[model samples]
Structures are given as C-alpha cells and as structure tokens.
Target: MSEIPANTRPLEGPAPRLKAPAGATDCHIHLYLPGYEAQPGGPKIPELATVEDYRKLQQWLSLERVVVTQPNAYQRDNRALLAALEQLGPDTARGVAAVTPDTPDRDLQAWHDRGIRGARIMNLPGGAVTHADMLAVEKRIRPLGWHLMVQFNGCQLNDYIDNLQRLESEYIIDHIGKFMPPVPADDARVDDILRLLDRGNAWFKICAGYEASLTSAPEYADVGAIARRVIAHAPERIIWGTNWPHVGVSRDNYPSDADQLDVLLDWATPEQQQKILVDNPARLYGF
Candidate 1:
C-alpha cells in the first residue's frame, strides 16, 4: 500500500494530558485542499491542510468529532468545505459554511443534507459575510435550524452589540471573543460577552488565543483571563476547538495543539471540561 502523505505542516506532537471524552468535538477547524484558488480580497491561502492531516491531530487529542469551519480564504465559495465534509464522513463531522442572505434555499438544504450545521459570519477583513448580513442571513438559515459561527475584533464587539442581540438563530462568538490586544478580565466589554451569553442563544468558542493575545504563549495569561470568565459565566454554552493548521504563524512558532488544549482545560473544572469538550458541542452541532 502507498504510504499516506504526512501534512507538510506536521500535526502530530505530544498528546494532550487531558484525554478528550467520547463525543468530544473540535468545534472549529479549517481544512484546505489543492486546486481551490484563494479568492481576491481574502487572506492568502495557507498550506494544504487536508482531512488526513487533521485525522492525526484527532488521534493525538483523542477527539471523536469535528466541525470544519469555512475559512475566510475561500469567501463564499463552499466547494472546499463540501469536499471536506465528504472526506471526514457525516457521522463524525459537521461543517460551518459561508453563505450570504441571498443564498438559495435549495443550496442551503443541500448543504444541510450533507452535514453542514451552521453558517459562518467572520466580520474581520477577508470575511465574505459580516455583521451587516447577520439578521438577513439569520432569516435565511433560521428555518433550516442552522446556527451562525461569528468572528470579529472583540474590542469592537459593542459596535455590533445591537445586531448580535437581534439575531434569532443561535450564534457563536469565536476565539474567546478574539479581543485584539486582549482585555482585562473585568473590562466592561467582558460584561458585554457575558450579557450575550445570558440571552441563551449566544455561545462562546474558546480557541485560537494566539490570534488576539499580546501576552504570547505557554501561558497566554491575558486571553486566559477572559476565557476563564466566559467559561464561568456559561459552561453549558461553551465549546472548544484546535483551530488546526493555525494560519499566519510560522511553523517554528506554531503552538503545540496539546499545550493549547491543556491551557484551556486548565481553566475549567473536571465537570466543566466534560461539558466544554463533549456535551456542549453535541448539543450545538447536533452530533
């Protein structure tokens, strides 16, 4: 048999000391395949991050399920996300795709049938759908029972607070609110996140701290403070992810996924760990 090609960017490393519970899900990850051109106005495509590569990380983390998030690099072109769902299998994987308010009903139904459970609204540069599209897109996906996975500069979360409050479908705020430069645990903006969580439809994903943390890693103390508070506020609504093939960072500076998981798990109680790792995602993504 031909040897399986390892990822050009290695995914295997030290296993996380916190063994993932059965049904534990990586609630966010992006998978890249060859032949998909990076669209204009989007971020440059990272190295090919295939299903095979992610499988290694899954084994290393002892995870059972995954949610493939639509990378901003592809914009609204969901061909890559669709292809990944096929490779990962519907039984163990789900997807969050990029779709506009104008996406046809037939296409939405088609994606749902294939195990796509949510729509992504990345409000940063290169995101195809932004906060402006939130309610309209919600109108389109609400009937389908799909949720929204949202990401933006958490520092400006208040700028979009009204719209976030207005969203009818369940929505997720990605990357521990992704507060650029990171905020104090007691900041009023953290209160904004907590308020949204109280609304019950809003959820928080704890991942990719490096994207917004100024404190650097091994202990992203700044991001950890915020993550702990968010988890404490709504452990039932919290979920975890690897953000694998972590883009932008050079390979030498790449975080060990094991260590990242440890850092977040450290912030949670053993019971909260079970909910964050397994229960919450199963409820949110319908796994």
Candidate 2:
C-alpha cells in the first residue's frame, strides 16, 4: 500500500464487498490524501480514504471504474488524488479533481493523462463558495473540455442554476441535490435539480453522501427518494456510488459496499438500474 499522510488515513474495518455487475462504476468516491499541509484559510484535510482500500472495495463491489473526488482536507493539492488515479491505472478508472483557479495548465494536462475528465469545486459547507470562485474556475477548466463537479447544500441549485447552466462545461450535481425526502417539494428542492437537468448537459450522482442518511439493507427513505427524483429528471445522467470510507461525515446506517449497491437496485428498475450503476458512468467518464 502507498503511504498517505499519517493524520488523515483510513480506519479499515473489514474487507469490502464489491458485488457489482460487469462494467459498473461508482460515480463518486474519495481518496484520502493526508500529509500535505495547507496554507491558512485553505481547504483542510478531512480524513484519508486510501486507494488501496477502495481497490479492494471495488473488487468487492464488482466495479471497474471509479471517480476519485478530492476532499476538503487535502485543500487544493490534488497530487494525492492524481497519485490515486495513477494507482488505479489507465484502463479501469478516472477522476474528478478539486482544483482552484490557479491550477496550472501543465498540472491539468497531467491530470488528463492520468484519466481525469473534470475538476471539482466543492461547496458543501453552505455559502462558503462564491459564484465568482466558480466563474474563475470555469475559465480555467472549460477550455480543457473538463466538467465541473460540485458538492453543495442549501436552497437546491436554484440559487446558482442559471450561472451553472449557462457555462459551457457539463455540470455534474453531487448527491441528488442534497434533498431530504418528506421535506415539501417546495423545500424539497427537486425543482432546482430539475432545472439543471433541463439544461441537458447537467448530470447527477445517486450517491450515499452523509447528508442523505441511508439505512443498509431494506433501504433508507432519503437516498431512495433522491434516486427516484434524479432519474425522473434525467435517468441518462444519473449515477450511483458509496462515497467510500464516509470521510469527515458519518452515516445513520453504515452500509457495507453491498448494502450501498442495493440502494440503487431498490430505487430504479433493472434497466434504469444498469444506467445508474453501469452504463451512465461509462458514457460520462468515457470508461
């Protein structure tokens, strides 16, 4: 196994169960890249989710492709995530990087070579991310044909939908709009998600983000609703994942890798299920 920063690392509990169908991909997952110190006010290293742990988890899930997301902990130093892509190799996996406006073209090209199709601008901690920040990053990444993968919560994407949609780059939503089911369609924020889909290039990940609060087997209401709503908006763009190791976040029901896959099966029909689990990601990530 490769050495990660000591402070941020995986707490391996059990060997994971992959059990996914052939050509399946987990649209979302994180690689803990600790040890890289951050400048003041920059992103902090949350917890490390090792690639080696995920590789075994992928085998357990029966998946061949994965999208490695750089977490808040590593800040903007994506070398760790890039290294994880290198570990994943050329044929099987790809990544979505977390980069700032200042990331060099060489570095971006380097990531492209390592199977990165996009750059991420995580905005999960409320209004901390500004549109100006996104606009600046847009200028940096769109020219490369890379998409923008965003992680945010609160008010759906309605607040930023127009700006997000108008951009030329493809927009991939994180965690089913972070909608909590049984919450009112008005407050449910499904409209905001639907609006992004109306733009055509926008996509969504039917993932187990901690905010969704999933129960292992028999399913959880939040994630199932998220999947249903996303598929309703754009089944072709919807995808599934475990968000492995859970990160700085925790879950209500800690599902094993298999437990997570079952969430998708429960939410969509067999064919749509294949789109969420296998086909959609292959098209989006070119897997």
Best by TM-score: 1
lDDT (tens digit, per residue) of candidate 1 on 43-147: 876577888889988888888999999988888999999999999998899999988978999999999999999999888888889888888998999998999
Report how far off residue 199 is in candidate 1 (Å): 0.9
Model 2 clash tally, residue pairs = 12
lDDT of 2 by residue, 83-177 (tens): 88888887887887766777789988878888888777666552233455887787788877788887666345567766786777787887766
RMSD of 2: 4.0
lDDT of 2 at 38: 41
Model 2 misplaced stretches (Cα beyond 4 Å): 1-19, 33-48, 126-130, 154-156, 180-182, 185-188, 214-218, 250-253
Error of 1 at 267 (Å): 0.9
